[model samples]
Target: MTGTPLLKVRDLSVGLETGGGMRPIISDIGFDLAPREILGIIGASGAGKTVLSRALVNWIDPPLKVTSGSVVYKSQNILDLPAQKLRMLRREIAYVGANPAGALDPTLPVGQQIVEKLRAVAPEIAHEEARKRVIDLLGAVRIPSPQMRYHEYPSQFSGGMMQRALIVDALVSNPAFLVADNVTQPLDVTVAAQVLRLMRELTTRFDTAIVFISSSLPLVSDAADQILVLAEGRVVERQATKALVDTPEHPYTRELISQIPKIWTSEAVAIDLPAETRKPIISIRDATRSYRVRKRGTFASYSTVRAVRNVTFDVFPGENFGIVGESGCGKSTLMRLLSRLERPDSGQVLCDGQDITRLSGKGLLKFRRDFQLVLQDPFNSLPPRTAIGAIIEEPLKTHGIARGAELRDRVLSVMREVGLPGTLYDELPLGLSAGQRQRVNVARAMVLEPKVLIMDETLSSLDQTEQFKLLKLFEQLQAQHGLTYVYISHDLAMVRRVCNRVAVMYLGEVVEIADNSRLFFDPGHPYTKALLSAVPTLEERRYKPEECLLEGEPPSPIDLPPGCSFASRCPNAFGRCHKQSPVLTARGNKDLAACFLVENTLSHAAA
Candidate 1:
């Protein structure tokens, strides 16, 4: 559209070679990307977005082949290049994928892995220079203490940190063009916001071009200069970001836009319960959990990670209570504490007036029947070799709840309840869609007839279409069974749509807790405000991202500071914030905030 394009595509198509014949996965796609511009490709899962990304870099493997057309980068058609030329071309073209956990080798240090990649792509570069570049890029991505983090393994990094490290890995070579495929999908809102801002800054600083791919339309609209919508292996719409969102010509584009959850509007769904009249089904009083891990590159030296510290909350019966935070804020550890998977080092976890921390033997089994934990990953959570029916029935058999035909009937009953057809009962989970597998997961939990369910980022991995359906199912199940849910997630939009009450955590502490309407509209703690500002939405933001979004990762849990953990990043932090920690105190009718600013205001008001 402007001066000589950096990359040009015309009539590109990709096909999967099947036994029946070749079937098209991407058909007749075309676009032009200029230097320093960002193009976003958005669609639901299985819309051939990944296939198109792979084809752009010529990374297509066996059973997948380019059926037609050309992808010309700098006047050379990449689709027609040989292996040797392609290998050399990679130095100027980089691709960063969605799943950072599996990208790097767990056995090697993260920085070492990145440096090795750099040396492989550009063998002429010296090892020292490559290492220095990787470290600098890591710092550029705002990973705290890059010099120390460089020696840490992949397992030692949290989800957000690992994702940022992967970006450094991609940019260390100074590639002119990048293909980032759903890089922020696994991150919490704040971390995702940080990553998007970093990408925008990189395009200006490095003069690089990018093709950002994701399922969420709002996320893409935030970062992309232009958007290309794909549906059923074809480009459905391509226009400037604001123009397309404000007035779309295609029906598919409109449908995708409709699926995004509303955050700051009257249409957003919320649960309003009379929580005061009911007792807490599960209550945590001053619960604290910690662990000891070996120091980086040290065999004997160890340090303590205070994963959850002085956390306390209560979930009223039949209420959807939400726990929201970024990665490494101890959401998972607190979930484990609530489910009794790991007992806290101190404090009490009570269930229906009974201390659940001390449950053992049959008592523990009974507790299991009363409470169920649904995990995040849909692929690895269930056994690959086991049949779906047998997987669901294992819990029944283990608890001795039923036998023979009775167990079979109960399993089918729940399978139907969760909208999973009975035909797949005998089939292994080999090729089931992510949503269907998650349905199996829900069926497994529902079959136990638990009164309370702890969902830990349960819907994070699925596309918005699937998440919406599952949320409706959860609501129907709750109404029929009178159930209570404790949702642990980094997805603030989803939490806003479903939860009656929401809690914000930072550096292993409860920074704020309030009703859903209050938390989103009038957050008290700076960290809570930061989380709200970072949520990706099409509506005008209640909290401006530039004013409240945090700048860097949370402080290390291994050696937390004596004062407020959030002080280092707080924009309004004063002298006292760096000297003394604050406790959760009353803010309004039922809201709580842990901030000296709020404490001072309340004191002044009383006087």
Candidate 2:
């Protein structure tokens, strides 16, 4: 690391245009990034970390302007730079935002897009050379089969994969500095670890100074050399990663630290329903979901992608059941089946012991009233033009449950239940913050008074404080309404906190199933253990490099390996593991794991 700084910000403040003139968003934010240094900027969702990042790059869009700030890059004030010079500066300083989908061009192939970006920045580079660099960068980001994935569009990639692709895009130009805005938020722990490792490698090899922005303190603390804590758009605390984590001086910083979910410790108490209510509220019996995708070159010939393969599990009444796995592991696909948004190709989806997989017409419509789905992106899930009141009331109206004053009363009641202010009832969803929008989503879901609520990565996008608040709200709602939740997420830390029973899935198969404490603390499956170990914690800044690091990306669900789906990556895989698939069997007193090693251990103990 050099004494000379790569980027410097002084007295930075940003403002948004409002009816009452300019309103301050971020005020008096100051920081410096030295060569090869990682500065982690962490705060709640609206804390203006993103605004500061955008200001540093001079990329703040209209209505949100840099009111007072001087961002200096290599002795040059970026805000004062001319358009052409600014463009050149941007080539040396890249920014990757939280939303990868927005960064990418949906119409173009991802690889082609990267190549285009390379050529745009360096016009002297040949197409062939740029293409090679694109593939190499993709590989560097741990994207499997870069050659094939290069030709695929952004739509074809999962959220985590898309985020990695954006990272590659940022690094493609070999920028001297990078602003990684919540890059690891969507990724599973394993992938996030790999990405962070790659970023560290870049800093060491190329001296790329980075500003790693995130909502989670522990996550950034693991990767960053220095930590800057922001609250209400101001820098509340700034310290070395260790110093900040060891003893956060600010109350907000301390509260943020306290909220981070720890896998090593168990604070979760299983919510036990009465014996009569403990029966399966929702059951998936050998459910399979497949999609036909056209071959790379030929439109006529298509191959089947088995997203969910023979997945079976039961969600008991009044209990939070979690399904966790890496991206493309069928967690979301299975949730869709439970929500009746998609029908399974085979097997049955039983609700209260009655098959609802093939329900249609009135049957399907009526069945929907019994359950609701809360999606990952609440803003997208809700209609932009519709008022929050109408959005929440639509479900109740569709079910023919109420109307007129009664409908408005029910909507207001549900809104209150989700902690949404009554004043915001007539306001459009666009006017609400991310957390508020999510609350609106929850209110809409609850308006029908559904017995089952399927939350598919709902809280994954929110900041830690918002997530904690929503989690608490979920518990209260469950207690008050007797709601049974089917929570599907890649966030194991969250799963550990909110779930009563948890199931670990890999490539569409359930590899492990146990109570939250057992699954996280004493995972029987190697894959489960690896996932848990990958999670970053304040106690351990860096996980042991050699321990529980997965070998490669998960094999394609379209053409899975002959034996176990995770066998190739499993450290304990043997001859039988390669030849045969292991079924979920008892591994401990109350846990089930689909691993030959676990089975062998159990057999030896019995003998």
Candidate 3:
């Protein structure tokens, strides 16, 4: 490493103004990035991960002005630099993040986009080489069929593909440093793992200093040499990744670590918790869902894809059962089916073996009362026009249960349960912080006091402190009211702490079901193992790719493949796995793992 910094951010303070004045989001925060080094920045959402990243690039918008700080990059003080100098520095020494919407002109083809970047940075380059360099950069980011993809517009590509193209565009200038902000957010686990691997390799291959910004710790843990943990715009912890993960000193950091999504592939609970005291409320029996998709064209043919195939599970009364999977793995769709938010195209969703899948009207209403859902984004889930109190009372009004004075008391009580006081009852969700808005969403869902709360990434956006409070509150609520939870999230570690059993979903199917202990300690499915491998550990300073990084994008669900849903990507894939679908078979202690490998290994153990 050189003596002087590549990018030095010193004593930076950012403020959040409300009502009439400014409050600090980041306070006297400082960090550095050296040449050929990678720095991972982790913080709970709204803890200033986004704020600090923007500040580093001088992208922080007005009303959230920088109070005082100097961002030194490329041998000059960036904050002190004149606007033109700063702009030049951005092109010469550093590259701000590539916003997919902002990076390329939407109407133009992707090939032209790459050329524009090259021409912008080095106008002297000839047309032939610039175009060739476009293909080379495209290949560098692992975009398949570069020739064909190059001609496609940004709109024609998937979110993942667009992100990759943007990454290519970002690096076309051969930047000395890279600041990647949530570049992997839109991708599924397999693709995300691939993207992370590519970024690490590119860093090593190009020797570019990088400042990686993300809300996910494990995602960045392996890739970062040193981690800068920020909270409310202040540096909470800065240390080597391994030391931080092994013995996280900060209370906030520890909570953040514990909140990662815990995946369940088989039915094995590590420890006994005070479980709920009721019969199995929801049951699954060979349930599956398939979809038929048709593309936009004059002669587009309809195609069918089988998503959830022969899946079976149970949701016990007052017990939390978590469902985890990559983006394309059909978790959200399955949850929606279970809650009757979306009707299944095939199989049965059994409520006490009554096949609630076929119910409607009164029967459906009764079933709906048993379970209520809260989506990932509360701002989207909650109504903008409605006051918090009214939103809470809406569910009760629909059920025709509570009225007038009685309903108001219930709403207030639920709000208190979720840490929202009476003062917030009439507040618009717009002004409230992300955490507070989520609180209102939870309060609204729990007001009628449903048996099961289906939270689809409910706490994804909150900072550590807020997430901890909410998790603790959830535990308290479950214990007090005997509520069953169907929590869905991407944070595996957090899932382990809260849920007793987990069902692992992949490509629209439950590949494995296990107790939290067994799944984390001895995951059976290849995909499960790969998922665990991708999780960042503070203990390991250097990035290591998954033992078998899943290969290929998930098959198009519209037309679907036969046999195992993971056949296309599974590293241990055999002829049988490719030819025949595996069924969820009985393992000891009510645990189930659906791979032929697990079946073979456990059977061999028994023999």
Candidate 4:
């Protein structure tokens, strides 16, 4: 705190060229970053966090300009630097964005792309040396088997691995300043915690100052030394992480902190299901789904990817059921089986006591009417060229349910229910906000009058404020229509707030299932404990991260080892765990878990 600042910004303001005139995006922003220090910028969506981050690195594009103030890095004002000098300065200032999949070239090997970037930044470095640095950095970031993964393409890497690879790319040049913009937003809790920890370590190791930008306050508090809260394009609060979290000065900052979900608290209550609807609206019994993929290098040799393995669950009517797991744990695949998008290899998917897998033609159409799926990624889900009204009305037209003026009325009615204005009905989705786009998605799904709605990471893309609003809307819609929700997500806090019952999946298998209160308070499976420990929160952790946090990734689904799928990563795994697979059995009142530790504990208690 006493040394020279690595980067300094004063009275900074960014403006966008609008039809009427120039409009201010971020005004009078000021911050200073010491060497090896992390300054976290926290705000909701449209709060100019991204714009401010881009401006800090002089990456602002046309129509958006830094109207005033200075961004000085190492005594040099970067905002006033010329094109040639600014390009050279940027090499020392790195940036890693939120979207990892779109950051790298798919055609090239993952390591090779970083090597190319290093060479471009410093032509003096040889190709082989650059490649070595990349491989070394990859390992430093905790990516497994860096040497073997060096030749693999981006598509071959999982989401968490690819994100770490991108971090390696940013640090390859040994940048003095790094801007990480929402880097951990898309990752699951375990992977996100890993990334946050890694970034803090990298700053000390590389002697780099980082500007960490995110929409999550608890997440920022976990990684940052100091926190800056933004609201409507202005700095509302700034203080040390503990000081701000404990005694907030600004009302906006207090509001942001209040929105954070409280786990292990009495705030979450178990929902009571109606006894009249005795049967489960949807049930999956031993459902297994697999895919055959050609090996990376082999021409004819292929591997079977057991995406969803013997997954069993029941979703009763009028209750919000949740499916949660890390990426590639087969949550989406299981959702597809429930929605009839894919048939199981050898099991049954029952809808209201009837096997819907064999249904086709009119029967399948009728089944579709009862089940609707809402996908993640609000940007790409809706058609860009189509009008909003037409997009929402497609399901109705496809089913031949309505037409003409009647259809228009129905579409507008659903739009109003989802809080979308009818004036934007004829507008394309190009300029809409992320929340607005998701509302359009909701309206489209609701127009069909489905009895069950399957949301696959639907709220993952939105900021906390938008997510909260949409969740309130969902509660109203469910209450009005008696709809059952199947929410599949990696966000544990959201799951804790909404779901009546939750199913925890691991490596294509259901590892644990319990009521909302039971799952959070007293988990049976070790894997479930690990997930809870990894969740980021301001409250005191119920599970110690150092003890329960897993070290390595799960074994490959294609070549899954015999015995318990979680044996390798589980901290409580034992000899029997490696020799025999555990079956889901009762642990408590309606609680089920597939772990030998639980079985042993229950057996010992009975003895």
C-alpha lDDT score of every prediction, in listed order: 0.90, 0.87, 0.74, 0.89
The digit string of per-residue lDDT tens for model 1 on 533-589 reads: 988998899899889988865677887877899998999899998899999989987
- Alpha-carbon deviation at 298 in model 1, angstroms: 4.1
By descending TM-score, how would the candidates be arranged? Answer: 2, 1, 4, 3
Q: On residues 451-565, what C-alpha lDDT tens digit does candidate 4 reach at each position?
A: 9999999998788889989999999999899999999999999999999899999989999999888899899988989999999899899999999988876787878888998
| Candidates arranged by lDDT, highest first | 1, 4, 2, 3
The residue-by-residue lDDT of candidate 3 on 447-538, one tens digit each, is 87788888888875554556777888888887787888887866665677788788998867788888777777777787777776665443
| TM-score against truth, every candidate | 0.97, 0.97, 0.82, 0.96
Writing each residue's lDDT as its tens digit, candidate 2 over 364-406 gives 8878888888899866788999898998888887888999999
Tell me how many clashing residue pairs each candidate has: 0, 0, 29, 0
Q: Per-residue lDDT for 373 in model 3? A: 85
Q: What's the true lDDT of residue 262 in model 2?
A: 68
Task: Give candidate 4 misplaced runs (Cα > 4 Å).
Answer: 122-150, 155-162
Give the backbone clash total of model 1: 0
Once model 2 is optimally superposed onto the true structure by TM-score, how far is the C-alpha of residue 442 displaced, in angstroms? 0.4
3 or 4, which is superior by lDDT? 4
> Which ranges of candidate 2 are over 4 A from the true structure?
540-545
